[model samples]
Structure formats: structure tokens, C-alpha cells
Target: MAGRGEKTVRAVRRPEVRLPQLAAYDGGELEAEGDYDGLEFADADWAGQSARGARFMDCAVRRCALDETVLGRARFIDSVLSGVRGVGTDLSQASLRDVEVSDARLGGTQLHGAVLERVVVRGGKIDFPNLRQAKLRDVAFEGCVLVEADFAGAVLERVTFDDCTLTRVDFSEARMTDVDLRGAAALDIARGIDRLSGAVISPAQLLDLAPVFAAQIGVRVE
Candidate 1:
């Protein structure tokens, strides 16, 4: 079943952009120079553009739409990204440290080989997102909905998914350590228990697992 899903995902290709190129600017509408850092880009429409090897430090990117944007080897440190729609964006080899992303939509986003540390994602919908070969440490996801998200071959440490809804989310072949799933809704957990090998849960979650144990032990309950 997983193999079939992968094949289906590979079959569907995203649409290409056809709009005129938008001029790239740096801080205070200045021309972007080499190794751009400490830039603030708010309410900018940077769609269908690739930002590679750029360093965005202490930036506030609000109400921006980076649809179909390719961001490779870029660093976003101490950034605030709110109300952003990064659909079909390729964020490969990107590093996002101490960033907060809220009210965002990241549909069909590719996060391969990305490093996310001390990041918080809240109130967002991340559909069909890929995190393969990514390293996530001290990342918190709160009040977000993830549909068909993939985390294959990823390394996750101390990641928390609080009040998130995960449907058809894949964590296959992911290395997870010190993962806390406390206060998470059981119905949000997609796939089988065997797939979640290294996940830690609270006692309330044990109540949800009681029925599986009861069935295995042949216990009769009212």
C-alpha cells in the first residue's frame, strides 16, 4: 500500500509558472547583494522564484505567498513567517532555526534534506508535504492539520505535535527519538501502531490503546 501511494504521488506533477519575473530586492527595497542577511520581507509576493544560498536573519515575512518557489541551501534564522502560502515550494537543503510559522499553508512542499531546529508551526495546513532526509530537533507543531505528509528517512528529536490532526501521514523509515505525543488526539494518529516505533505518549493515550490490548489478550469488556 505504501509503495502504491508513493507511485501515485510521483505520477502527479505540479503546474509551472507563467507570470512575468518579479524584481528581487533586499532590505529597504535595496538591490540584493551576495550573502544577504538580516532582511525583512513582509507582505511580498515572491512566487515562482528560487532563493538559493541566501541567509535571511531576523526577518519578518508576513502575508507573503511563495508559491512554487525553490529555496535551496537557504538559512532562515530567527524569522517570523505568518499567513504565508508556500504551495508546491521546494525547500531542499534549507535550514530554519528559531523560526515561527503560523497560519500558513504548505501544500505539496518538498523539505528534503532540510534542518528545522527550535521551530514552531501553528494553525496551518501542510498537505502532501515531504520531509525526507530532513533533520528536525526541538520542533513543535501546534494546532496544525497535516494530510498525507511524508517523513521518510528523516531524523526527529524532541519533536512535539500538540493538538494537530494528522491524516494519512507517513513516518516510515524515520528515526525518532525523545518524541512526545502527549495531549495529542488519538484519532489524529494515522497508520498502525507498529509504524510508530519510537514515539512516546501519555497515559491518556494508553486508554486509546486499551482496546487493542484487550483484543490481543482475549478479554471481554462491556
Candidate 2:
């Protein structure tokens, strides 16, 4: 478990590079050619593309928007996607390893059936995002606003949410083993913790959890 202020710093400004336009690419391998050592994509729009089996290695995408993009079966390794926004994007069956997606807005994104390992999502608004049936291991979410997000039927092992706002988020029917919500703020949210069988929270959050506990156990916390 990392602290609330823990962060990985990388070089902010790098060389500029334009991503290849796949006008009619579908179900093909779009692997990175050569080492993308110091390439950055700024203010680019990658919308409505079927990017299946695409790989992004050692790449940095800054201030870019990937709205309504089909990213199924894509792989993102050692990539930094900062200040990016995606709406209604399909990331199903994708794998993200050692990826940092910070300061991004991923509203209405579909991340179902994805495998997330060593992925960090910090200081972002991921509203209405779906993570159903996803395999998440060692994933850290710090200072994120996950409003109305769906994590139902997901397998979350050793997942940590630090100081995140989980308002109206759903974890119903999800297998959350060793999930920590110690410093998270989710009081005004409904059905967020309705299926957290083995999750833990801090003492301050326990006060908000008392009513739900009382309703389940038939006891008043006065």
C-alpha cells in the first residue's frame, strides 16, 4: 500500500511524434516500431478507431483525447497517458502493465474483461466507467473521483483506493479480496458498498458505514 502522496515522476516535456493513422486497420497488430524513447502526443484526437491488438510501448500521450475508440485486446506497457480524456471508449480485454493514467477524464468508458497490473490512476475523474469482470491486481487509485462507476463482477485482489471519491459507485457481486478503502470518501453514495463482504475502511468512514451495518445486523449505532 502506497501513501496518499506517493507519485512517480517522469519527464514532462519530450519530443513530439504523431501517431500513425489507421484509417482501415482492424484486427491487425499495430506494434510500436523502434524505441519510442522521447516521443509525445499533444492535443491529438484518436476517435472512432478499431484498435484491436495494438501495442503502445514506452510511449507518452499527453493532453490527447481518445473518445469513442475501440481499444479491445490492446496492450499498453510502460506508457504514460496524462491529461487524456476518453468517453464511451471500449478497453475490454486490454492489458495495461506499469501504466500511469493520471489527471484524465474517462467518463463512460468500458474496461470490462481487462487485466490491470501495477496500474496507477491518480487525480482523475473516471465517472460512469465500467470495470465488470476485470482482473485487477496491485492496482492503486489515489485522489480519484469515481462517480457512478461500475465494478460489478470484477476480481479485485490487493486493490487500494486512497483518498478517492467513490460516490454512487457500484461494487455489487464483485470479488474484492483485501480491498482497502481506508482514506476514501463515499458517504453520500448509494449501493457502493452493498456487496463488500471483506473490505476495510478507516475509523472516520466507519461512522458513515454504521447505518448500513445497523440495517444489516438489526442494531442501532447510537
Candidate 3:
């Protein structure tokens, strides 16, 4: 729909995580800087454990409990994490590439300064996720519910939110490129309405956000 050489935005590249036949992780506790590859972690209760700088490649983490677990600077590549429930899980500065996280139940999860590429998060509820200063590329969030999510000072490229519900989300000073919000089922911005320069939204969504937009520019809509 360009009359005079307007730019056409490209969509995000979804993650294709094909996990290999994995061995079961029957270890006692996750050690720091541990290298885990081609393993499966199911129904694990690793609350209050520290696994800083751990690497998981071609693994499956299913239905695990990560309450208050510290996984700072962890790296996950070509992995799938499904039905994982947790609270206060710390994954600060972690890296995830070609990963899929589905049906997760998390609260107060800290993902600040994380790096994500070709990651898909589907059918999950995350509350109060701290994603400040994160770098996300080609990330898609589908059929998810996010409450009080923070993206302050983050960089997002080719990120799409499809059929997602966002409540009280903050995007303060965030930078975006080719970010699509057209398929969001609900959108509620608690802060930083002025930081949506590179995002695309539907006409109906724009109308719904008119009041917030007006307030951002001090427009008296009387």
C-alpha cells in the first residue's frame, strides 16, 4: 500500500526446534557452568538451585519446577521447554537460539539483558517478567498472556505478537524494527506509549489506543 515508495516490513522468522533423541538428566543438582547436551529434564524440582553459565543444547525441559532458580548467563540452543512452571526464576543475561517455550506458567521471572533469536513462546502466562535491556530478534509470541511485562531499553527486531494478551506492559525507551502487533487480541500499555516508532498495529488497535496517544502528546480530546 505504498503510493510513493514506502517501505515494506518483513515478518518474523519462527523457530524450528528439532530436538534429537535425548538422554534423561538424572543428575542430583545443576552445577554452574555445566554443559548439558541432548538431554531431557522432566518434572525436575530445582528450586533455589544455582546453574549459572550452564549450556543446554538439543534438550527438552518438560514440566519442571524452577522456583527461585538462578540460571544467569545460561545458553539454550535448539531446545524445547514445555509445561514449565515457576516463580522468581532468574535467567538474567541468558541466551536462547532456536528455542520454543510453550505452556509455561511463570511469575516474576527475570530475563534482563538476555539474547533471543528465532525463539517462539506459545500458550503461556507470564506475570511481572523483567526483560529490561534484552535483545530479541525473530521472536514470536503466540497465544500467550503477559502481565506487567517490562521491556525497558530493549532492542526488538522482527518480533510478532499473535493472538496474545498484554496487560500493563511497559516499553520505556525500547527500540523496535519490523515489530508487528496487528494480531494481538488485547493490548494494554502501562508506560512508554511514545516508543512505538517501528511497530505495526491494526487500525482498530490504533483507535483503541487513541486516548493514550492523545495523552502522550498532551492533546485535549474534549
What TM-score does each of the candidates earn?
Answer: 0.75, 0.77, 0.96
Cα displacement (Å) at residue 125, model 1: 1.1
lDDT of 2 by residue, 141-199 (tens): 88999988778888887777777888877777888666777758553445545566556
Which of the predicted structures, 1 or 3, would earn the higher lDDT when compared with the native? 3
Question: What stretches of model 2 exceed 4 Å from their correct place?
Answer: 1-39, 187-189, 192-194, 217-222
Candidate 3, 70-153: lDDT as tens digits: 999999999999999999999999999999999999999999999999999999899999999999999999999999999999
Better model by lDDT, 1 or 2?
Answer: 2
**Residue 127 accuracy (lDDT) in model 3:** 96
lDDT of 3: 0.93
- RMSDs, each prediction? 11.2, 7.6, 1.8
- Alpha-carbon local distance difference test for all models: 0.70, 0.72, 0.93
In angstroms, give how far residue 6 of model 2 lies from its true place.
Answer: 24
- lDDT, candidate 2, equals 0.72
- Among these predictions, the greatest TM-score belongs to 3
Model 1 over residues 70-137: C-alpha lDDT tens digits?
77778877777788897898788899988888999878988889999888888978888888889988
Residue ranges of candidate 1 with Cα displaced over 4 Å = 1-34, 186-192, 203-222
Kindly give the stretch of ten consecutive residues in candidate 2 with the minimal lDDT sum: 8-17
